[model samples]
Target: MAPMYDHPGEHAADDPIRLLAVRDTPLSLDEVHRAVGDAAAGGTALFVGTVRNHDGGADVAGLGYSAHPSAEAELRRVAEKVVANRPVRALAAVHRVGELGVGDVAVIVAVSCPHRAEAFDACRMLIDDLKHSVPIWKHQRFSDGTDEWVGAC
Candidate 1:
């Protein structure tokens, strides 16, 4: 039998837990999107963050991401807040660590809600908060033979 869902405002304990992950492997948007899929959701919003080839007016050669051991735990905490404050039916977020070249997907986030606006708002909140609060750092190698560390917040 199919499971039932909360109509809109009920904080049902049976609501599906949001997906949160940080790994030293390839990241997939398809996986995150699937995680947030729900039969009761009328809208889904996804955000994919990619490693661009430039940073701060410099041509970026490559990049690497590193995370503290507590990164995953902090990720879950951030997602928890999103679920608590938003009208989210499902949520998922994943971040990739290790060496990455241009155009690699660095992070993927998704949110599902009963309405499109809610989904968009929740998804944006999840990603922005994750970026600002998480203890993940980016090491950027510029094409001019210089590098910088950024966003350890």
Candidate 2:
């Protein structure tokens, strides 16, 4: 499919793939980055969220992610918003669902822009908005044999 936006000096179809998905499989940073690879872009920014071993002063043994049916669609909306607001060359993001262990990559996002500052700002906006607005929930398993869910569907 063609890129959703075409700016001056940049053909919409000339951009790389724009990925948006929520899946049970492992996510690859390289894959997301590659999707946003654009020769005309002077800067590419990436963000990776890993499963850490702790949350809320509790030791986390592992975690699982659950997504609402609209999670993927919401992700696409978020990406499109970033694209419309920024001079992005290309963008991609993937979020891993199902169970995850400590150090596992939970989410990966990449954005390419014509300038470094724009790339950084857009990348940050994409991730921050995604975390706050996406309908993805986190279930944390504590070392003390308890669990709780974070975020609403």
Candidate 3:
């Protein structure tokens, strides 16, 4: 699919994949928001994923995230896919690794587009694809003395 923008052949310098990272530090909403700021974009959409206290009826006692060496490259690929055939003006995504407590931001993604609907769609696609395809695994320690890994290949 062809890329969407106001000017054709002029977006090479204005790449849409603005920010992509896999960090051990805490994620920031302001950073993601600032990365996707575009002059031409009329709407910006954001999604924040947090570590919840419970999952699948199990009380999560602790959580940690580990990522493969290629996780950042894989994240870039996911972001590219979201901007490939869409009207996305800019996009940013960050996933946190290492130990985290409940209510901590695990992931943050944002997208800017010429319209609200496009921004929403692109942002949704960005986060969904990142979670499913990125080489990041979650280790969950439950209150019942059981532990499990999620999204490990």
Candidate 4:
């Protein structure tokens, strides 16, 4: 199927895929859903990672994220891998940094494909690979005035 948006000089019929990478102040599930929506797409899958109030029974006050400047480049590489491994009609990934309160979205991924199976597979692969390979790190702040640096936890 054709992509909903096409590049200049490229026919919509010729462009079968679309991809986006963003760094947002506050992430939204609706934004992710919109990025992957296309009439030609038969399936869409999304993953959202959020901050929880407690970890291992610890009172989590908040969390902070840090990333190398090359983090966006690395995320783009993962997105490219998803496109290479599946027939993705549209895909988007965004990760937020800085301080976040409990229940805030940390990351979001959306993928659309021609079939449900590939959509699920690609969505999972995108999140898994991103968590494993991305340079972003999180610092968990506990209510006890303690902090821990977690590597993709």
What stretches of model 3 exceed 4 Å from their correct place? 1-12
lDDT of 4 by residue, 37-126 (tens): 778789999999999999878999999988777777777788888888898888877888888999999988879899999899999999
> What's the residue-level lDDT of 52 in candidate 4?
96
lDDT for each residue of candidate 1 in 41-144, tens digit (9 for 90 to 100): 99999999999989779999999999888888778788889989998888887888889999999998889999999999998999999998888999999999
lDDT of each: 0.81, 0.82, 0.83, 0.78
Candidates ranked, most accurate by TM-score first: 3, 1, 2, 4
Model 3 accuracy (lDDT, Cα)? 0.83
| Residue 124 lDDT in candidate 3 | 84
- Overlapping backbone residue pairs in candidate 1 total 0
Error of 4 at 75 (Å): 0.5
Relative to the true structure, candidate 2 reaches a TM of 0.88
**Cα displacement (Å) at residue 129, model 4:** 0.6
Task: Write down the TM-score of every candidate.
Answer: 0.89, 0.88, 0.89, 0.85
Q: What's the lDDT of the predicted structure labeled candidate 2?
A: 0.82
**Model 3 pairs whose backbones collide:** none
Error of 3 at 130 (Å): 0.5
Tens digit of per-residue lDDT, candidate 2, span 71-98: 8778878888998899998888788889
> What total of clashing residue pairs does each candidate reach?
0, 0, 0, 0
Ranking by lDDT: 3, 2, 1, 4
